[model samples]
Target: MIRDDHQAGPTLTSPRSNGARISLAHGGGGQLTDELIGGLVLPRLGNGLLNELLDSAVLPLDAQHRLALTIDAYVVTPWRFAGGDIGRLAVSGTVNDLSVAGAKPLGLALSMILAEGLPQRDLDVVLASVAQASSEAGVPVVTGDTKVVGHGQADGIYLITAGVGVVPTDRRLHPDSIKAGDALIINGPIGEHGLTVMLAREMPEIDSVLRSDVAPLNHLINRVMTRHGGGVHFMRDATRSGLAGLAADLAKQSGRHITLDEAVIPVRPEARHAADMLGLDPLEVANEGKVVIVADRNQADQIVATMREHELGKQACVIGWVGDDGDGICELNTLIGGRRIIQKPYGEQLPRIC
Candidate 1:
């Protein structure tokens, strides 16, 4: 049975080990990522606003308003993928960051880094995707700049996107507000995007029709936040480190144990098969179009039903719940009736994975 009470319990082990030097795992959005940020980044550059590490920072714009600001850099290799291009990924990624923070995206600033000798046709395709994504998200790219670098100095194309969104005065979404007993919700299947990209590069011989699950989620998120408002405590877009990394980070930040059931967490059959073939855990792979919601159990049923009504959330499910078992630890209840710690990746599993 699910329990909703918050009580102090045993101290669970942290995801990070005593290590030095930055590695790809540090950027994989797991324990190592946390150590890099908490251990080094925070002590030096953290302020009241930056320390929280929310996808978007809520800045007080005036006595009556707050603005959410976030920025991201995209360097996905190949520039083009099965479901999206670099341009679309850049737009959708930034827009989702703002939306997850309970913001209504207003505008975006884009900057492009073009490598010398890159084909103009490739740039055109990426730009077209950016335009389509921006239009669909209802957030305009109001400003941008472009630069060219020496050949081989960079990938064919790189993009930097910064977004601004408005958060309603009455709503607040942050990990600090998440309490034990809140249900953990996932919008849809995980690992499709990461696996699709990996397969394109690593095992092109294994051909399948799988495509990246990359899309803008602002409309889907806006529905839930507007309807449930205060009942929704925290939300995050599962990106670089997939769901496993997200759970680990949430546990660490909220000082609560997040227990997930393997049987209930949704994964597409093809995605699971691909992950298995690669010796990867689907939960630890990356995603481009997924969101994790922490909300009151009382509101979870309604939330899941509402999510199903949206195309992006049609596969939404209640994956887990927060509890007071091991402080700042994340665990998974295995299908075989055992428990395992879900830790952040130590090094990059798939480099340039957006």
Candidate 2:
């Protein structure tokens, strides 16, 4: 069951001051976003399930089954990008949230907010994309709602999706299960999705090969869980604030150090160049088609070999490992025999690239 009534009210405050206000950075999924959720949202509404703060909330439905639910809103500008649009993003994002939590997606509920001047052709195109993505993931859009707003009120279109899935009672995936000797593995390269969207929105004139890596990862994850369920301890998709953000959060939550090897982290040359040109760190860029997994050290090699057999996991490899020392610190071993600490980005670096 879900609750909409809470006695407490929202407590908003500027990141730098005592005054109450909201900033764009608050939605960037960085430090500000964390503060907003931890300080304000949690104080007013956090409960046993919500306090867990996993990608999706897992709830027991009966003696033999458990339910996982997740909701997300997409306000990505341009509505369309090189490899995907907002519709595909909404579906994939919601589905991935459930999958990482060890759930088999059941269905989705979609809600759309449309601007008055939005074109019907654009709406039809987006809906078609949504249907196609849902079919690819083997899930259905079971219900929906639509609302029209004044011209310019909505950014052409906005999508909100809620996904429900079933988790086997035996499956266990959470940060608390992570251990110092566990290995960190990622399915593929990072920075493609965020860089693609940024270039498409800002420098449409410059031709590049970058394309948003936006696709549902449920099948790929399901295969991994089937073979290595006993070894897998935790999983999280590197979204909004990117791989660095996710790694940092994992370290803090598990109370262990995370050390990443820069040489092994897969990054395409084109993506590296684009990031350097834009003065952005590729490690902090968002990705829609990637997930970070923590698994037993003994099973790491076999897991990578199995992952490489799938299309989505073609470049899968071990990028890091949990350490026995430090208090929630994440460090990167540089290619030049140097090291640096990784921190969650303080504020918005690349805005609206989600």
Candidate 3:
């Protein structure tokens, strides 16, 4: 819990580079990761459009049209999982990135890097999943390239997918649009995707059943946008670094104090226990099939009700509210009525769990 009297300066929440060599944590999507982007990457390649740092970069096509572009790469160790495979992850990940930006996905470009000695049968399965997921999301695969690496030089397979979508003429969603007193909502439980992947790799001996919650969320997001429009100010898919990461980013971007009630957040019992056993915080894990939304306080209830009408949002609930904080902090109210600061993790709990 953050102390009520605690005051902070107007420091940017973005990451800063410290001249240290890159580590896996830099890509973990946490505090250090943000620093790498803000300090190093952005300095070298950033421009006005890139500086916004939204999941997808929104580009203006004309006065009435805007394009959203986002790209994601998949390198999950096993490639195949209980609920989905890398192919599915590639599609869902890219599609969700565009969707969360309030865009209607038009198509995707798939690129593949294959290692020598990779099995043809495995490639078939992965490509099939990709095709199916693309069709299911109604986003066609428009263009792609494939490359092969020498043996021992690459993982079995790696997938890079880029997507393009069209933002509605009337929609203007960004963290800048959020303010204090706004309500935060999450669709469905958290940690399933991270826990599922961890269990499959670290504790395969265990027999507990848990599957990754990997699905395309464009339709659900479109539904909310259609009704709420500007009322829904910000949206993010809680992927790497989980809900905590999203919360911290939002707080910093909005420059507001974001507080969450731990008791009200939904987490599957299995995920909770699994996280406990693994000595990890479910909030800091990853999620592939969940979304976090920030909407006007007056419209929060209606937004939740509308979310519930969708299968993907059946478990949606308001999790917290924004507060006046000059320092851009995120706080969590625990079960014992204690409040504490929710610091973003320095790195992800598990590597390559996405």
Clashing pairs in model 3?
A: 1-339, 1-340, 15-34, 15-35, 16-35
Residue-by-residue lDDT tens digits, candidate 3, 184-289: 9998999998888888888888787778999999988888888887789889999999998889878877778999999999998999998998888999999999
Best by lDDT: 2
The sequence of per-residue lDDT tens digits that candidate 1 reaches over residues 1-354 is 112121111112342454455666666665566666766665567666776677899988876668999999998876787899889999999999999999999999999999999999989999999999999999999999999999989978999999999988777887778788999999998999999988888888888777898899999999998788778998999998789989987887787899999999998899989998888899889899999999999999999999999999999999999996658899999999999999877668887889
RMSD of 3: 4.3
Which tens-of-lDDT digit does each residue in 1-354 have in candidate 2? 212321122234543467667789989988888778866878868887886677899998987779999999999987899999999999999999999999999999999999999989999999999999999999999999999999877689999999999999999898878898999999999999999988888788979998899999999999999999999999999999999999988887777899999999999998998898788999999999999999999999999988899999999999999999858889999999999999989889888776
Ranking by lDDT: 2, 3, 1
Ranking by TM-score: 2, 3, 1
- Kindly report which residue stretches of model 3 are placed more than 4 angstroms away from their true locations once superposed: 1-19
lDDT of each: 0.86, 0.90, 0.86
Between prediction 1 and prediction 2, the one with superior TM-score is 2
- Top candidate on TM-score is 2
| Structural similarity to truth (TM-score) of each candidate | 0.92, 0.95, 0.93
